[model samples]
Target: MDNSKLPINQIIARINDAAEMAREIISEANIFEAIIEGFNEAEGTNLKLTDITNLEAAQDWIDEFLEKYSDV
Candidate 1:
């Protein structure tokens, strides 16, 4: 089970897959950031989007916001 013995192509592919996952995470962060910005604008509240370092925190804010603001 030694990854160092893997072929160069396999190593490159694994790196590429990791990069793709990083990109996906950034995309999700951007989407959440936009929502946070809109919420701040509409509510006049300065909820720091950048302060949220991960998706879970973003989701927590979204959940709380919905609970407090959603009528449906």
Candidate 2:
């Protein structure tokens, strides 16, 4: 975690790794938001990320949504 003490190459490598991780996290978040929005549109309801209390419930909702509208 102490990138300051690392060599230049190591520091660059760590920075690159952190950037990649950030990109992945952002991508996943975007996908999750899109799925939630799609589900809300299909169901004619307005829901937000705050409405889902836990990851299991979110996954369940996504699964059900996809099962019901896989053709789209």
Candidate 3:
């Protein structure tokens, strides 16, 4: 597949366009809140993205859960 003469750049441009459209439709905070909702459901605990001090800490908190349940 890597050696194929496909228009990889064009394909990537299309993907970028879709991502840009999605960004216009939804804020990162909304995505983070959705992730927090999933985390709460999976862990059987209530959590809120707004409670996190910063994005970095929010990322770390998510990484911790992913690491703990990586096998699943």
Question: Using TM-score as the measure, which candidate wins?
Answer: 2
Q: Candidate 3: how large is its RMSD?
A: 9.3
Candidate 1: pairs in clash: none
Ranking by TM-score, best first? 2, 1, 3
The digit string of per-residue lDDT tens for model 1 on 1-72 reads 677999999999999999999999999878778777778977998877667777786678799977876773
Better of 1 and 2 by TM-score: 2
Q: Number of clashing residue pairs in every model?
A: 0, 0, 0
Q: Please give the lDDT score for candidate 1.
A: 0.82
Give the alpha-carbon lDDT of every model.
0.82, 0.88, 0.78
Per-residue lDDT of 1-72 in model 2, one digit per residue for the tens? 676788999888888999999999999888988988988888898998778889898888889888889987
Stretches off by above 4 angstroms in model 1 are 53-60, 63-72
Predicted structure with the largest lDDT when compared to the true one: 2
Model 2 vs. true fold: TM? 0.84
Per-residue lDDT tens digits of candidate 3, residues 1-72? 552565988778778999998987678778777778878888898887658988688788878877876677
Off by over 4 Å in 2: none
Candidates arranged by lDDT, highest first: 2, 1, 3
Off by over 4 Å in 3: 1-26, 66-72
lDDT of 3 at 15: 81
9: Cα error in model 1, Å? 0.9
